[model samples]
Target: MAGLVDALGPILELMTWVGFVPGVPLLVWGLIIARRRCVWTRTTGEVYSAGGFTGFRWTDQDNVQRQTLVDADVARGLVAGNEVELHYDLCHPARWALGRPKHDNTVLILGWILTSVGILCTVGGFVLLLF
Candidate 1:
């Protein structure tokens, strides 16, 4: 069998660009959302389910209705009409998050680290090819 690096070289190189391109924005948004959430106002929102999917609905400060899928397991006993504390985006109140998503953050941070290392490897690989 080929060496592990040789087998995975192309994948690692491509993933570097892919993760770096999207991961940067996702990481930034995750961080910004996390920081803003620190001061999110407590609002009474209804958690609803239909067709095997669950989501939350609430009205923002501007009185605009908003809805988002709830993926964070930080809260429990989520049923219809279960009042929950939600965090809204300061810039866009319609955007919301139930609570801190550790898994998501860990993935974002890991993607960044891996992408950074991949970029270095790609540069070295290119240099080796040229030489």
Candidate 2:
């Protein structure tokens, strides 16, 4: 029992830290912030790297070329020399991610999944308490 609960530690911690009812909304809010705040610019970039770490290069607002390597999570599986859209902050272009966030947005998917599991645990915790 302790092992199982421990495996769910992160989810439990999210609820405990943010409160169960607000946890999912907080996640949703974060997603909304990402979508709204990130500057979506159409440009071509080269995706290179493998075995988990990947990177890409694109020009910023200042026309300064930029590349994200060893730190970009969405850089994998993208082919090289192919034109790709990139999403990044104008003030912080180095932190850019893949464009077309509607497709294969790993961060969003993981966030939703984590939020769901946290909600489930919150409900279970309440039930356990009531019993």
> Which of the numbered candidates is closest to the native, going by highest TM-score?
1
Candidate 2 residue-pair clash tally: 0
* lDDT against the true structure, each candidate: 0.66, 0.63
Off by over 4 Å in 2: 1-39, 50-53, 70-76, 100-131
| Model 1 lDDT tens row, 21-116 | 766676676677556543345477888886766788888777778887766464346877787877776576655666632334664576567567
What is candidate 1's CA lDDT for residue 21? 78
Best candidate according to lDDT = 1
1-131 in candidate 2: lDDT tens per residue? 76666556556556654553554666676687667664556567776665666677777777898887745445455665556777776756766556453434555566676667666767766655443
Alpha carbon RMSD to native, model 1: 9.8
Judged by whole-model lDDT over C-alpha atoms, candidate 2 comes out at 0.63
